[model samples]
Target: MGESSWAIDLEKQITTAEVDEEEIKRWVIDLEKNMEEEEMKTSRSIFKVPTQTTLLHKNAYEPNIVSFGPYHYGKSHLQLMETHKKKAVDYFLKNYGKPLNNYVKALEEVDQELRDSYENLDDEWKHREKFLKLMMFDGCFMLKILYEYKETLAKPGSENHDHFNFDPQLCLYIRRDMLMIENQLPLLGLVTLAAVQTGKSTVLFVLSFCYFLKLESNSKNSPYSNYINSTVFAEHTGVLNLPILIMDEITEISFLNLMAFERKAKGMGSAVSSFLAFMGSLINSEEDARFLRSKGIIQSTLGNDKAIVDCIKLLGKDMYFNPHSEMCLTQYRLNQYYLNSIKSWNKRLRDWSSNFMQTYVKNPWTLISLMVAGFVLSLTVTQTYYSIHKPK
Candidate 1:
């Protein structure tokens, strides 16, 4: 049993005291004591982020997740739309970006469908045309639109998604930090667009952000904030945590104002109201997540072993989480948020359906059809999530 009598063993038992995370500490403790004693060893601390994040020049140009609310203060919407446009513009101007393709055009071609399905119906079926050209469908006109708007909008062709679609799309995922910035946007102004249910957009946003993190972790630099920055993918988290805060004070302030003012406006649009409600979810999510994270006071792998999960869930929605050595920081927590958001969203969706059902209770079958569609959207989201996380 002497240390010298040991066979060729490169193992060290993982002591509960050495593991910084509460979850990991519990996990190790749950293992057979003998195996753990023989397997664990003194390990280096894996907390802290890098001093400077390496960023891809292209990523700095990548789309931004937005908290675009009502259209009047569309400075937010403009930014979001520009993000998509950046992709289109990149195809011709940037370097090696892709074309918008027919998917966008299909929407344009289905004018009647747009009229049939859209609440507002007619004014802007073609208004988005110029946007389509500069974003989705490239044409000779793109250069002209790019030319005229360059001086006014951000460096012209370099406009980001934030400038284009203040409203988040399935593709636009706002980070916690983006809305946290002072005067940029309020926490509530952000759309839980990345969530799966009520705000499936939130789920899409986070998934997309993760993809960016993965890509930026490549040999290139990534402009994404450190919390989820891919640039520091390797290298031990070091002193600099991989997370960065994303805050937009203006967005938040404007959103509060927009809600107060729009409610009394004479010609209020349902789209505008619906959009505001969506933006409000971000705040609700932060509140709820924070409450959940604080449930049992667990430690994290972040600096000084702080309660990072709690922070991001509540006030930290504006913050991105950094990485820890040999582990994925906040993955479980983030997934939990996604699941919770999805659950809430589904319930809200049902509420909306119930309202629609009452309107068509006379036919009964119409009520049945709407219910079917809601069911389908829900299933689509489930399938999407499973496919993304399937035993990889």
Candidate 2:
């Protein structure tokens, strides 16, 4: 009777173990299904700086003077810019003749989409009203900067009354900060504001903004100047007709963040990504930096040539790139240039033996003189050999 009772107890324990295993399997399956559903939804475009990039150059990724998005929004050092941003917003509304409420309402409508653009925003920023205000203020400020820049360009040397232009260095730093990867507002915000204010498209606004970033024509000092001069600008507009060839002065942080955002939001084949990869390929050394400088492809007030090279290297550190993406004809041309340079060097090496001889024997008189000298040396050597063996 004791043996029978023990067997029954063991069987009940085994049954419970089986039930637990089945429950665990069901839980795992549900977890995977939920993960798949989440992936199907749109992912965030703005990201915290990746560990690899940040570890190399933390200062490059951090905002120094002004912060644009929620990532660095409330920093004590950046608070000074808040007042300027508010003023810019006021100016934007006044110029567009739209009430602040209208802009706020527009932002509210796309609030969810805007939130989706940024990864891991703070809980306080999660509130709809707060998020809308953030977007309204930030977006308007960016639009205002672009507007003022356009005006300045349109009417140069005409009593620069813009507050940002009061101190050129401060303005430059702010512009640089705006380009930082962590210091970005959604392009959607800018687009919405532009559409509401003017009947123009986002492309025009982007082009104008980039222009304000000072992407001038390729300087004669740029290594790419010859290539640019040889080809028609209209033929190779890259992936989006962006003026990527003249990105010499853009800050490292700005370029990296822009490319990161483009990659996340627009996918792998954006013109911005392609241009970055192309620049990365070109900038491997100081010589490369010098070449770029010669072509006016790079212009920096960051001291010297080494600084520029270091900056480019840091910008490209651990960058995400797909080699097979569509970069228009730019990638193909760059590859061909690299291959041709190698082939040319090989040809020079192959002709090196002939070149050496030609160096000393270029003219007919020089060739005859060398031949005579060689014949005399050979005759003297033969005579010496005979003397040494003359039955000594």
lDDT of each: 0.34, 0.69
For model 1, residues 98-215, the per-residue Cα lDDT tens digits are 2334234433554333222222223443466542332232222222232234343445354352333333333224332122211121111122110211223222234323332221
Query: Which ranges in model 2 have alpha carbons more than 4 Å from their true place?
Result: 1-43, 93-95, 160-165, 198-204, 212-250, 262-266, 269-303, 319-392
RMSD of 1: 31.0
Error of 1 at 203 (Å): 15
The residue-by-residue lDDT of candidate 2 on 139-249, one tens digit each, is 877877777777777899765647555476887777888777688888888888877777565544444444544444434233322332233223233221223344345
- True-structure RMSD, every candidate: 31.0, 10.3
**Which segments of candidate 1 are over 4 A away from where they belong?**
1-73, 76-88, 92-107, 110-306, 309-392
Full-model lDDT, candidate 1 = 0.34
TM-score, every prediction:
0.21, 0.64
In candidate 2, the residue pairs with backbone N, CA or C atoms under 3 Å apart (3 or more residues apart, or in different chains) clash, namely: 179-254, 221-293, 221-294, 221-295, 221-296, 222-294, 222-295, 222-296, 223-295, 248-298
